[model samples]
Target: MDAIFIQILNGLDKGGAYALIALGLTLVFGTLGVVNFAHGALFMLGAFCAVTTQKLLTISKHVQDTSITFFDAYKDQPYLEIWWGDFGRTIIDWSVPLSILLTIPAMLLIGLSMERGLIRHFYKRSHAEQILMTFGLAIVLQEIIRSIFGANPIPTPAPDIIAGSAPIGALFGLDEALVYPWWRLIYLLFSIITVSGVFAFLQLTTFGMVVRAGMHDRETVGLLGINVERRFTVVFGLAAVVTGLAGAMYAPILSPDYHMGMDFLVLSFIVVVVGGMGSLRGAVAAGFLLGLLQSFASMNEVKTIIPGIDQIIIYLVAVVIILVRPRGLMGRKGVMED
Candidate 1:
């Protein structure tokens, strides 16, 4: 029972990131009908946004410290600390949290630019063309990041107050040995909140109504004197922002690296396919389902029975779902099937 609970928590943690990325992918596909292969690159850029903020906060200068000269002749003090003392140190220490401010605007601008300058031109093009061009763009973005930040993973830690593991089992009246990372719990909550907010925004707001209408029948909405194209552009930007924020939050959980986006991209694509393309609810559902299955497959008992089942579990599930549903778990009549 304890092991089962722990694995459930682990699965939810993994699923949160998967669902968030897949949600954004669905938004872009539903709104613009564009296969955005570069969506993962946007995620990578968001993680880098956190990294960049950390770097900016910790800009340092070498100074001679007569009080301490054991390791080096000069001591490095972050400019923020050197200038503002404890407050600057606080900011530097909380770099991960503070970076959210930087990521939002950065991702919005990047999304808008990509849509206006590049993706807009290819909307009427074939999916193959869209895939090729976006894939190329993703490669280019990743290469640019590599050139700037290098190929190594950069660790961005959570705040000191929540840096350790949480005794999750205690909350459920179980053994304390079943502990989970505090940040992972926070991430799970954050993902839930974000997903809820998006749904609420779309369901309750007038703008959301317009966007939804445009998505279903663009020509009809445009005939009603609405700028469907502009709304679609904004939707694309919103999708970028969603994916970017997910990446930003995940930086502390997994170190940000140039290739991290590519790693998640394939899995997220599988998630979307299994969930049903263009279905927001399906994406979220499939993400958690696969996440749980993967978690159980990793159990020692399961692995003992079927060696290496953990690795292939997700793909196996995807294939089964695809073969059974064809269009996906919740896909409409003529979505990807057409």
Candidate 2:
């Protein structure tokens, strides 16, 4: 039971990232009728933001080291001095969460620019064309990040306060190895807050009301003199920022690398499909469900029975869900279009 509980916690955080990513994809599809292949790239970019911020924060200084513990180390008369002339390690050791925060506005701007400059032109393009264009864009974006940051997995160090394994099992007076890391718990909470805020914004705000209306009928809303297009652009940027924030926060739990987005993009699509192509609630629920199940599938017992269950868990769930509900858990009629 304890083992199961820990796995459940692990899944929630992983699934939360998926849910958030899928939600953004659904938003773009639901509101704009365009399938954004760039969504995952945005996610990738968000992770890279952390990578960039970490690199930016590093106070790199060349240091000559003579073993301070050994007095004879300087017997060769070689003097060691810290170069870059500053304490580069001090700032990094002090704050990591701050970089994630700095990543938000940066990602939001990136999102806005992508929307205004590229996606705006595709609002009326055919789905196939949009996919091709955006996929190409994603490729370009990934390559750009790779060129700049290299292909290595970038480690995002957690804040000093929450730097180690949390011992979830230890809290229950169990064993030591069953500990959960604080960064992951923080991730789960952060995703929840983000999901909640977006939900609340849509449910409680006038702007959200307008956006929802625009989602249903851009033509009708335009007829009523609403700036439907402008709201959509805002929403696009919002979706980008949301996904970017998710990616940025996720960087610590999962390594931030240029290719990480490609890994997440497929599952996110599956999550959206299983949740319902346009349903936010469905996306959130399905993300957790799939994440939990996937976590369980990796267990020795489950894998022994199903062999390679980890790789197949999501696809299996997607198949069953799609078969059970053709339009998704909450898809509206005609939203899938012809």
In model 1, what are the clashing residue pairs, if there are any?
none
Error of model 2, residue 319, in angstroms? 2.8
lDDT by residue for model 1 (263-294), tens:
88888889998899888898999888888889
For model 2 the TM-score comes to 0.89
Cα displacement (Å) at residue 115, model 1: 0.4
Off by over 4 Å in 2: 63-90, 172-177
The prediction achieving the highest lDDT against the true structure is 1
| lDDT score, candidate 2 | 0.81
User: Residue 199 of candidate 2: its Cα lDDT?
Assistant: 93
Weakest ten-residue segment in model 1 by summed lDDT: 65-74
Best by TM-score: 1
